[model samples]
Target: MQGYSAASLKPIFDTHIKNDAQVLADGWCGYNPLKEECPNLKQTLSNKGKNFKMLHIQIRDFKNWLRGVHSYCNKEYLQKYIDEYFFRFNRRNHRKINFR
Candidate 1:
């Protein structure tokens, strides 16, 4: 995160987000080239009024879930854990239809 090189961020941003998706970020140099990388990217900067409130809440909830359920997850397995969390969260409302 300290370096703004595309090589360093490709794995996190390029791989996870689609080229047409808009990106929201703080006024950080790392995100400055988002529009350049993805021509359709609508980059937004939050100068005030809790720009990252939803993201912050999700991270906080994820941390709490990990701490409460797993006690302490290792860094190596954190991404997989996060992926599973997203999977379950995304399908939460489908459980009723799925079982019946």
Candidate 2:
């Protein structure tokens, strides 16, 4: 979101995430307001990214891919790049069927 505040994240959370969906997040104060709406939301200390190794790895890999492939990207189209990267990453094991 534009900022890591409860106000900045609430709208996106309300629109895209179901109230009952299990939401896992770091212990950021920004998510405090969401608990009332999302009963299943859980927060834990990030422990300097060590608590979520795989997630951090994926983020790092995506950044590397963006730097290596695109070199630079316009902020306006950054979301499109992220969507495309995840789309391909999600289907990496099904390449044979992905084209069909």
Best-matching candidate per TM-score:
2
Cα lDDT tens digits, model 2, 3-75, are 8899999889978999999988999888998899999999999899988888999999999999998999999
**Which regions of candidate 1 fall more than 4 Å away from where they truly are?**
1-4, 11-16, 39-49
Q: Pick the candidate with the highest lDDT.
A: 2
lDDT of 1 by residue, 31-81 (tens): 556667777655456645377778878888888888888898899998899
Count of clashing residue pairs in every prediction: 0, 0
Per-prediction TM-score to the true structure, in the order listed: 0.69, 0.83
lDDT of each: 0.75, 0.92
Candidate 1 lands at a TM-score of 0.69
Q: How close is candidate 2 to the true structure, as a TM-score?
A: 0.83
Residue 34 lDDT in candidate 2 = 85
